[model samples]
Target: MSEPPVSYKRHRFPPQIIAHAVWLYFRFPLSLRLVEKLLLERGIVVSYETVRVWAHKFGPDYVRCLRRKKPSRQDIWHLDEVVVTINSEKRYLWRAVDQDGYVLDEIVQIRRDTRAAKRLLERLLCKQGCPPKRMITDKLGSYGAARRKIMPKVEHCQHKGLNNRAENSHVPIRKRERAMQGFRSWSGLQRFVETFPAVRNHVVPPHSHRSAFATHLHRLAAMAEWKSVTLTAA
Candidate 1:
């Protein structure tokens, strides 16, 4: 048989601690130093650099595993982009989400044009395995051009109000940018953005018309799912 997961092999810290550190860094809008200080209060003496290394090393794997555990997405998709300034350079962060506010995929680019929109659509198609019944976007001509070229049959609604779902999704990333004081490099930014939404999708449950007990049970299930996904390779 193949060896068991090496989540903690040769590491000074246990898998639980390392996983917790990675979780804290991505799950919340906390900086590496803050994560270190929080752990220090708990008697863990990990440095901020160690936490940074742990995030870059483990975050992508965790997100990939988490995505594998998600259910099939909706037929309606929302796409949008926001400007992220790093070291005085402006970049575009393209994001796509389903009708129920579940993040599907995101990417970073220096240009916001038909090409960028097509790139996002292609990534969505490859990952989602199908085009949506309809897609909503702001009054961006690039989205119109790209949608026509790629998924021409998928209804493209270009309305400001109609794309609020996608626009609203940027709020969290904007908050994160402030916490980290903006990303230093495009490659580094892309790496974290790609993984962050998957983790968010795993932890967040759809809002319910059901009772509080049902919500609590769902949260318990989400927590259990998180542990199982993280330990799959451990």
Candidate 2:
């Protein structure tokens, strides 16, 4: 006889707990331990290690699933790179976000040269399946080289203050990094930032006429659809 199908239930932490934990990590720049302490005060006894694991595992998955069901529309992309210290060594973190602050792609590389920029752009284009109408970057000459080779037709603009949008988007990530004691490895940094955008996008409502309640309802509905689709695919 065929085995019975397994049932996977959602986590038992109240929606408030899950939401609060995610909010604290993404919004306020709190360490997993700090968040664990806060939850304990509310009578929940989860461990900080568990919180870190949850943030690493479910955080990005949740964000991706949420976006898959309700994809954002962004035709313009702003790309930038930031230097971060990992394991006492300096590394580069490449980030791409839309004009509306939706994170599109992120990666970590050991170098910040033309090759690194090209790799980051290629990965972003492959995932996004096309170039944005316009790409904005700072005065970095490497950006010019990458754009010329990969997205020749796409407008590349480099001017003072023009790339601030992408630069400003890094602030939240910096805050989060400071709270978590900075990343220890390039892999860890890449994974966390990759997941960070999705979580951030989930809490932001699209610019539309929908009420906050309506937006929440839509997000919940999308989450349900994502769960069903993921289970079936699995």
Candidate 3:
């Protein structure tokens, strides 16, 4: 069955404006106030808090409409975790990315152990609908333990040098964390990661060596798709 269209019935602004605001916030590391200022410069007259509300409200709906990475038996999964400081407490943000530099799934947890690794792998399997051809990670024993139990047949490579794809994936989120001055809570961090990575992966092509013209065409297509998925009412 086809999903229902997202309703934008009662808002004062048009769906385009709301979608654009959400896009500016997630598609870049821009702050809420920065988004507000940008809109105001165009005579939109919205507050930062309103942009925040729109992002939290409509971001998930947009994510649901975006195309996800397809499951492939040939895909190589790169799994890694990073420390996030929330309210003076340290939490681990576990993420899995495919070889093409697309984020597959992410989770926030308090522990960095075999159990945590298992949880991430379980979620990945559920989302991707199959185990990958191979899994790569740093010299983390937890990943080895979890892989042995969860995907015993899949090849597992544990080497710091071989896992640069996963490690480099953390850079964007780290920049966003610093730009926002740090996340306040685990739930907030989770929500941010959930929307941010999807938007980034959608607009930013994975190939690093594409020509300027090719990159331009890719972004043009990405913008068109974004407008279609967000139901831009202009």
Best by lDDT: 3
Sorting all predicted structures by lDDT, with the top scorer first, yields 3, 1, 2
Q: Tell me how far the alpha carbon of residue 210 in candidate 2 is from the true structure, in angstroms, after superposition.
A: 11
How high is the CA lDDT of each candidate model? 0.83, 0.74, 0.91
| Predicted structure 3: clash tally | 0
Q: What is the TM-score of each candidate against the true structure?
A: 0.92, 0.78, 0.97
Better of 2 and 3 by TM-score: 3
Ordered list by TM-score, greatest first: 3, 1, 2
Residues 1-234 of candidate 1: C-alpha lDDT, one tens digit per residue? 432333656788878888889989998998888999999999999999999999998888776655343335347888999998888889899999887788888898889989999999999899888788889999989999999899888888999998888999998888788888878799989989887887887777653376888778866777776677667333
**What is candidate 2's lDDT per residue for 18-111, written digit by digit as tens?**
6557556655678888999999998999988877766675566555545432223347788898889877899888998777667788888888
Q: Which runs of model 1 end up more than 4 angstroms from their true locations?
A: 1-6, 67-74, 207-210, 232-234
Residue pairs that clash (backbone atoms under 3 angstroms), model 3: none
Instruction: Give the Å shift of residue 173 in candidate 2.
Output: 0.7
